[model samples]
Target: MKKYFYFLFFSLLPFGCKDTNGKKPIEITTNDSSSIYLNKAQNKNTKIADKLKYYKKSFTILKNQENDSITRSKLFELTKELYKNNFEREFLSSVNLLTKLATKSKDSFYLAQAYRSKGSFYKHQATKDSAFIYYTEAEKILKKIKHKEGLSLVLINKSLIQFDTGDYTGADRTLNNAYLISKKNNEIDNLYAISVMMGLTSLETKDFDKAIQYFNYGLEIVSKNNNIIGEFNKETCLNNIGLSYQRKAEQKKSVEDYKKSIEYFKSALKNKSIRTEDPELYNLLTDNLGYSYLKTENLDQALALFLESLKIREELNYPNQIVLSKVHLSEYYRQVNDTAKSKKYIFEALSLAKKEKAYRDYLNALKQASIIDVQNASTYSKEYIRLSDSIRNVEILSQEKFARIQLETDEIIKEKDILEDKNRSLLYTFIGVVFLLSMLFVVRAQRARTKELMFKQAQQRANEEIYNLLMAQQDVIDQSREIEKKKIARDLHDGILSRMFGARLNLDSINHLDDPESVKKRLEYLNELKEIEQDIREISHDLSREKQDLINNFVSITTNLFEEQTATHSAKLTYFMDSSIKWDLVKNNIKINVFRILQEGLQNINKYAKAKTISVNFRKENNELHISIEDDGIGFDVSKKSKGIGMQNMISRAIDCNGKLDINSSKENGTKITLNIPLE
Candidate 1:
């Protein structure tokens, strides 16, 4: 025989703000003086009917005066608040008022809000299709405005419908969207609602661990808030956590989990907030606690709890809940071997379930009845199987429809996002195009001024060129003398110094020897001296050869200068010299001037450019030696900034080289200094 555990499935209700006058009410406390304050507050709340009548009269008076959108919207909002406790009649009236305000104002926000309120009203009436239609309409407008809070509420409402219709997959997807929006907006109430719904979804999917986590998180939120809805959610989460433990107990056959489930359920029932605010949840906790006791074979405690739950359900006249209670009682009687009482309770449960058309309840009742009704057990068993199959098929159909609607809704939202992105991109692109056009005009004007300045500077450059040539020749001469001195110093250190030391050692050794041995060692030392003299002669020949090989002109001077410049700074310098470029063929004056230009460019890069990398490329193209110096550095505006002395010197050197000097620079694009010289 299968044992059934009753679990509470709490539905999330929309929480509304209570409208009040701008005065703070007296605080209600546990003291005797506070009792009078609490009584006055109760009496004030009791006059809600009179307040509603006054609001209607005021609304009618306001409608005659201005008929303005703001005034009408305010009245609509006031009327909506007055109908919070009234479900069907007053809620319908609020929906009408909202619709009228939306039409008059022609505002999408008002229209969307109206649709949402209508959806809520329809949802409360259990007209799910109408509710879905209204929710979808509201969602369209809310998504258009990117109203996350309203969209989240709509999603939560739609998910509830999906959940009730047994579309767990669809409901889970919808709730996930709602949860993200609520979390992002920090909508605590919506977050509490979504979290609890997610727990229930987890429960349905048999994901007990996730269910427990979600329930605990929701309970934490409720504990901090301590409002009417918060208290309700707290009780709901408590009940859900107990249900989770019960399932875990059943799965693992754990006695400890059952005891824990009982503890949570009892705690939920004892909670003052839950006890005072939520009778339904209180009864659910009682029934769940009884099941937990039954799991541990505490029959007396189980029976007493079950009887209390049944009494509450009976008083409330909730047929489904009453059926659940009777079913549990039947199971309890069967456990204690009270065959007649078990049969009696099971029949009563079946009658109630059939009246309510709760097929699951009816099936459960029949299955239990069959256990005791031996002879007619097969008939009852067959009927239960038939009903279960029918219900399963209906649920499958509902899920398919729900999934299709969800897919369409998601696609619509995706398309809206795509459209928004495209619009934003187009706007940015338009702005960029306009900016580029303006920059083009500015660049053209700058180029014109740069060309005029370069033309005027050309004549002055010629005079500077002659003076630079004479100075460069002297520098080259000085560098050559320095190179020769270094070579002579190295030759002396390696050759003359080594021979002198060897000769001293030989003499010292001769002193330690006898007369004949000393004479022999002296002769050997003399031969070594002769060999050293020959080595010295060879060194002189090598020096002449090195002088012949050395081309201490433009290429050599430029390479040496580049090395020195890089050694002094952190910037990296790279130079490329084409093998085909014959440095000897190039005129000395031209080479010197080209080298000077390159030196000046490098100096500028080191001092002002703040460059990381600089490259110098020397290549012969069509009898022209092309020398280009480039740096990845912060460049100056060639048109705006006047040429400095260094730049003028570089231009003068290029003029003396009989080459064209082209300088390309921009603020962010770096600088390229190209000097094209004729080799022929």
Candidate 2:
């Protein structure tokens, strides 16, 4: 039969050189469930050491395999067998291989499953931090893939590890997330795990109703599966459920579940030949059963179970468990009035716990030991307080070390993030510089075109200005000609024409006849002479009014110039003058030049001085008419800078008008120019 199975195993193996070609050797088949069953059929020993050795040897061979999905699946199947057999070292290797293969294959579902298995293994081994890391990694991956079943399994595993670490709130929080996902996907196994976690957390928090509900649900699942491990786990949940009830003062119900859990555990022990068992699990059930018996004052049965658990823990070489069993045994002896035995066990527990640095267990032992003799009780009480203080100080030191480590980790992460940000910023800056160079080239080309357009605009403006100046000069010449013509015509009509008409009247009087008709004709000729004199007066008045209108138009042009300068520039302009200026005394040419000078002064004030206040003053100062324009704004060095055409024109106009223009300006003060012209 061995030769036939060997043939089958070799047939399953891929044929290749058993070396660098990555071909799996034939030894892996011995690590599978079929081999275990074959060993059982042949009635072999199946010891833990032998099983562990076989799996480890098999892993060496499997790693050389080409590692396809089929090879990965075979490895995972072998992992399940090793895990069940509790081959810790080989089990971890198999888990790692599966995880690596799943990642390499890019199979998220398989990777998540491998992580869950590894985390659960760590949890069973009591390594909570490692368990939580793997569980969280699996959860994040499964969530992204929308693998609800895988996500629920990871969450339930995380919740269990949280419970073990005494984090009841965190355990319940994770259980709630798992419960929602399990319910959505109808995952019975994940739901069972969630219910068990909830029951345990509620029991820890002293919520008896919630604890019982969840425990009952978990027990129902175990009953359906009829799994020995599941049944063992259900007993633990039931025991906790009972403890919760006892804490709540529901003694009757508490006793019922405790008795039920004990009965189930005793049945589990009976079937031990067919099923693999953990020494720790057996010790837990014994301890809890002993506790239940002690609570009910069943001393004989409690003592028996406590001794059994103690012997098992001692045989397993678990120091903490041994200390715990000793402490409980001491309590049992003290209750039975066996003072010597009680003191002996209590001291043993204290010494063992203190040696192991198990401060909590030491404290519990001290509390129990204090109850013996009154004198000893007081001494033990003081010792307990001293130890408590020492333990607290040690915990504080541990916390500071943990905090320092965490801070260093955060700083490292921050530095990494800053480096990443600098890299991104450099990339953006490179892009921006490239864009700016392109834009600069575009702008340089555009600027050349703009310069050409500006040259054309300057030429066009010069031509326009020359044309406007000629038109203005023509207007002035035409007005002068019209004025002279009117004056000449008026002189003829008023002086020469009127005098000639009077002479004609005198001649008519000399040639008069001695009849009534001659007399009437002479009267009519005198009337015509009077009408001609009136016409001459009207023509003279018309010429004088026209000359006055020309002067007014010149004043109007200056007013408009001032308005335009004020509106268009930043300067606030103010023009104030007496409505009745002695304009008739000023010659037409002088009036025109005065108006031009004021217009230029207003323009100069706006351009040179960035003034907010500009004022044009036109008032009579004694016998002189004074016109001043001032700006309460920035003043510059006028003498240092050459004057522009506008400023030169203004000075020239003042000189022509016989106006003494005195300018006073400073940088700190503002510019004020005064024009003093004679008003005689």
lDDT of 2 by residue, 1-680 (tens): 01110111112111111111123433435465444543442335666566666666556656877767656656666676677666777778888989999899886756766777787787667665666767776776666677675576667666655555556776688889889988887666666666766876786677777877887897787777664223355545444554455545434545665555555555545545312365666676577668667766789999999999899888888777788889889889888999899989999998999899777788888888898655689888998999988866754554444335435645666786799899999999999999999999999989978998999999999999999999999999999998667445434533344335444744465565768766765676667566656655755665443234448675666676667565446668888876667766666856755665665565566446778988887877677778888888788666786776555555665675677877788785788888888766
Q: Write the per-residue lDDT of candidate 1 for residues 1-680, one digit (tens) a residue.
A: 10122123223344342222123522323243223332332355657666555555544544454545454455445445545646356556656766776677666766777787787777777787778778888778877777787788888888887777777788898899888888998878778877878887788888988989988998898888776343455667787899999988989999999998988888777777655566677777889999999989998999999998898878888788888888889888889999899889989999989988888779888888888889899999999999989988887877776566667877888998899899999999999999999999999989977987888799789879988999999999999988666545544543355445647655875676778868877887788787767667766766432223233555565666678667556889898999998778766556545654665677578657889998989888898888888999999899998986556666766776678999999997789998888878
Per-candidate Cα lDDT values, in order, are 0.73, 0.67
Q: Candidate 2: misplaced stretches above 4 Å?
A: 1-68, 78-101, 223-229, 232-237, 249-322, 336-338, 355-360, 373-680
Candidate 2, residue 514: how far the Cα is off, in Å: 99
TM-score of each: 0.58, 0.44
lDDT of 1: 0.73
Model 1 worst lDDT run, 10 consecutive residues: 1-10
* Candidate 1 lDDT for residue 331: 89
lDDT of 2: 0.67
Q: TM-score for model 2?
A: 0.44
